[model samples]
Target chain A: MNSNMKFSRKTEELVNVFQFLKKKEIEFGCTDRQKMEIDLCVEEVFMNMVRHNSTAKNKIQISVNKTADNKIIISLIDHEDHPFDITKTDDLDLEDYVEKKKSGGLGIHLIKQMMDEISFEHQRGISKITMVKNI
Target chain B: MLTIEKINDNEWKFSGRFDASQADKATKELADPSGTVTIDMAGLDYISSMGLSVLVNTYKHLNEQGFSLRLTNLNRHVRDIFKYTRLEQVFDIVDPTS
Candidate 1:
């Protein structure tokens, strides 16, 4: 089964999306660790959208699907005109000490590390980010 | 969903989820520290990048004032986030039960 949802570009709406993903993970027989990883990836992407496009009153669309090979796919689409390819973000220097480390790029770094695969696309004035995890 | 309990003047216990929604409040509560500050994370279920950022900032601030920040009782999941972010080397983390 596949599910899709739309919510305003507000951080408060993230709770709803998280709850929905948790319920779907259970239905897909995902373990707790898998569910948590997916939740973290979703939150990182959604927060990036909110922080970058906060001035625009756009809606974000999220969809979840399970592939035949037991892969969980999640897609996030936003109407923000600017394209942000998270894959191209600066590599987090994990070796940096806390006094010198920059947290700005940490979220995307976590998402990249947790997800099996991640891709970004911008077309027709819309940006979409897709992430997949094996259950 | 974050709770900060004062164990003493230099120690505090943090419980619950420390996500984006709670980052601001957690930062405000963690602003001040004395010579040494210990944060108990045994009851913490989850912590996101936002929370980690806050903690990092707090660690820097405390260090600047000749203070130290320590964390104890990190569950497996919480420890994993720190390890993934490479924050394990940045702070003084101790396993109180070990």
Candidate 2:
């Protein structure tokens, strides 16, 4: 599954791209629960990038592929280099941030809670995250 | 994705995300107003602080124009945020079923 797409900082387009992922998942004829999970996880990841792409001059590359081992692999690469991966986070300490809600972290926490196998690879000034969910 | 539907001569229900991401679209679509607008949050799933700021700014803008903005149908998640922020007392926050 070789696919590549470049996106801008536009939030609306980002939303549509997530919907496109949902459509692709449906066209693949996967299970209902799996499809919903795929759609939501994809949406959260993309939205997280959108919320940060502006500071990074709107450079985000996203790829989706279904591996031979029955796992949906989604790769998110961002030009912004800060050495942080939100995909593996498990602490949804809403208590910590609710009173003084800080931007750029909440969405990622939510995404980590939903994904299955999330890996981080930062190289050449780019952060690439690969998330695999077994359907 | 924002729209205004006339519920009555006095109240209009607003649906959609009113955040910084879509604030311009929301302001443009809600240009024409009557007396008061009751935003129905039944269809809204999530919102951010930017969205809350947009609502506060919109409330101020509408009030300046003699039209009040009242929020209704705020979901539990959003209500929690508002309650945490002590804004539930400031906003109407009508029941979702209504």
Candidate 3:
């Protein structure tokens, strides 16, 4: 099954997005661990788009699909192509980060750690991120 | 929605999903504490990076004052989050059930 939603580029809309994913998870059936991972990845990607692409004009579009082979695919499309590839971000050095007490890169770091497969593309004034996780 | 219950002046309990929207609520709830703060995470099933930032900020704030934060009863999902970020070393995490 596949589900899609459009949300405004605002942080406050996170709850709605969360509920949308949860509803789809219940409908599609996933392990608790997979659900949590997908939730975290979706949140990281959605929030990243909302915050970094604040200048974007259109709503963020997200789709969730569960495959027959037990893989969950999620994609987030932002209308404005800001061209920030989260995959290219360097791995976080925890020791140095803790020393400085900085918090900027943790969200992207978590996404990289949790998702099984992640890819990003920016073209034709659209930035899209796709992530896959197996149950 | 996220709930932060003040178990005591130095201890707090977090329940429900702790995501970006709840950051402000968490920050205000954990603003000031004189001693080492202990957070019970038995009921916290989910947490995002923004939620982590709230705790990290609180930890740093308390650290500068010669205090710190302790987290307990983190489930596998939450525990893996700390482990993956390597934040497990930075914060004191203990599980009495183990």
Candidate 4:
């Protein structure tokens, strides 16, 4: 089964996304570890969209699908025009000291490390990011 | 929702979601404490990048004042987050039982 949802750019809407994912995890037979990773990935993607397009009128759409190969795929679509491919972002130097490390890239870094594969596409004034994880 | 409980002069217990929504409040509640601050995270099951940034900034602020920060009772998931981000090298994460 696949699930789809639309949410505003407000941070408060994250609760609904989390709840939706939790229910999907149970139905998809996701392990606790897989659930945690997926949760973090969703939070990072959703929060990034919220922060970047806080003033935009377009709503974000999220879809989750489970494949026959025991893989979970999540897609996040936003209507904002600015081009951004999180998969192409540079990795943060995880070894840097706390005072010297930059915080800007950590969110994307965590998402990259947690998910098995990520793909991004921009077309017709929309940005679509798809993340896949094997269960 | 997030709740912060002041246990003492330099100790606090945090519970609930520590994500973007609660980042500001959590930072404010944990601010301006003296000495080595110990944060109890047993009840905190979730944290996001915003929460991590708050913790890093707090650690820096306290260190400049000759103080330190300690985190305890992190669940396996949180621990994995730290490990993934290499935050385990920066924060003093300890066992709750110890």
> Would you estimate the TM-scores of all the predictions?
0.94, 0.58, 0.94, 0.94
- For candidate 1, the iRMS in Å is 1.3
Q: After superposition, how far is residue A21 of candidate 3 from its true place, in Å?
A: 0.6
What TM value does model 1 have?
0.94
Per-residue lDDT tens digits for candidate 3, residues B54-90, read 9889989999999989999998889888888877877
| Per-residue alpha-carbon lDDT of candidate 4 for residues B51-91, written as tens digits (9 for 90 to 100) | 89888888888878988889999887887788888887778
DockQ of all candidate complexes: 0.60, 0.14, 0.76, 0.66
Using DockQ, give the best candidate's number.
3
**Residue A37 miss distance in model 2 (angstroms):** 4.6
Q: Write the per-residue lDDT of candidate 4 for residues A63-130, one digit (tens) a residue.
A: 99899999999999998778678888876766664447445577898888888999999999899999
The reply for model 3, stretches above 4 Å from the true place, is none
Interface RMSD of each: 1.3, 6.4, 1.1, 1.5
Tell me how many residue pairs clash in candidate 4: 0
Model 3 chain B scores worst on lDDT over the 10 consecutive residues at B89-98
The whole-model C-alpha lDDT of candidate 2 against the native structure comes to 0.62
Question: Each candidate: RMSD to true structure?
Answer: 1.8, 6.0, 1.5, 1.8
Docking quality (DockQ) of candidate 3: 0.76
What local distance difference test score does each model get?
A: 0.85, 0.62, 0.88, 0.85
Query: Model 4: what TM-score?
Result: 0.94
Off by over 4 Å in 1: A97-99, B96-98
